[model samples]
Target: MTDTPSPLTYAPPALAAREDLLAAVRFDAAGLVACIAQQHDTGEVLMMAWMNREAVAETLATGRVCYYSRSRKGLWRKGETSGQLQHLVELRLDCDGDTLLALVDQLGVACHTGRRNCFYRAIRDDALTTIADPLMDPAALYGDAHKGHSHG
Candidate 1:
C-alpha cells in the first residue's frame, strides 16, 4: 500500500504565490520536468531528478526534496534510505518555465554511488575522468533492496 502525502500547508499569501508559480510551469508531454538540485551555499550542482507537478508540490509542502523515480514508478523522497536528504532552501524556475532549480542544503552524499554529487565525472584530457571519491558504501546504505534496480 502507498502512503498518501500530507497536504502542504503554507501561509496564505505564500501559497497563492506558489500556486501562481506552479500554474506558470510548463510540464513536458510525459508530465515530467527536469529538476536540478544545487548546493545552496557553494552553488555546486548536485543531482538532476525528474519531477512531475505532484513532486514539485510535495517538495514545497515538505521542504524536503522529493522526486519521481522512473525506476520505481513512484514518488521518491531523497535520501529516504541513504540518509542523504536534501533540505530545500530555495526554488527557482527558468525563463522557459520548463526546468526547475532547487537550491538545497544536502546532507551526506547525494549520489546513489555514495559520491557527493552525481556529476562527479568530467571530461579531462579528452577522456572521462572521475572527479570525486565515494564517501560511503552504497551496499551499506541500500543493501540488497535496490539490487534489481536498473537505469533505463
Candidate 2:
C-alpha cells in the first residue's frame, strides 16, 4: 500500500487562533468588559453594558441573560425588575476580540426609558431627533427613587 499522510499530522490554524484570542481578552481591574446588546431577529443594537467573566459564564449556563451592573457593581439579571428580559441566543466576539456582541431574543422593551432600544434618538441634519417612544413608563416600572433594584 502506498504511504498516506496521517490525519493527526494536520491542524487548522483557526483552532489555535481562537485559543489565543480567548487568552488575550482584557478584563478591567474589576474583571469586567463592555458587552453590546443586539436584537437577534431585527439586528438592532439595543444598548451597551459591562460584564464580568462570571456574568458571561452565568449567561451561558442559564441562557436567561445576565450582566454586570457597573452602577450597582453586581450581576443584573435582565427582566427581573422591568419584566423586559433578554433570552441569550448567542454571544460573539469582535475581530480584535475585545468587544462582545450579545445576540438575544429580547422580550418587551429593552430600554429603561420605556423605549424599545436605548438608541432611540437619531441624528438628522446635524440635529438630534427622537425616533422612538417609550413602551412603558419608568415610574411604573421602577417606581420613584428606584434604589437597589434587582431583577432576579
Give the winner by TM-score.
1
TM-score of 2: 0.76
Candidate 1 segments exceeding 4 Å error: 1-13, 148-152
Whole-model lDDT for model 2 versus the true structure?
0.72
lDDT tens per residue, model 2, 76-115? 8888877888877766677766677877878888877778
lDDT score of model 1?
Answer: 0.80
Error of 2 at 74 (Å): 0.7
Each prediction's TM-score against the native?
Answer: 0.86, 0.76
TM-score of 1: 0.86
* Each prediction's RMSD to truth: 7.1, 9.8
Q: lDDT by residue for model 1 over 41-152, one digit each (tens)?
A: 7878888888888888888777888888888888888878768788887678999999999888898888888788888889999999998989988897688865764321
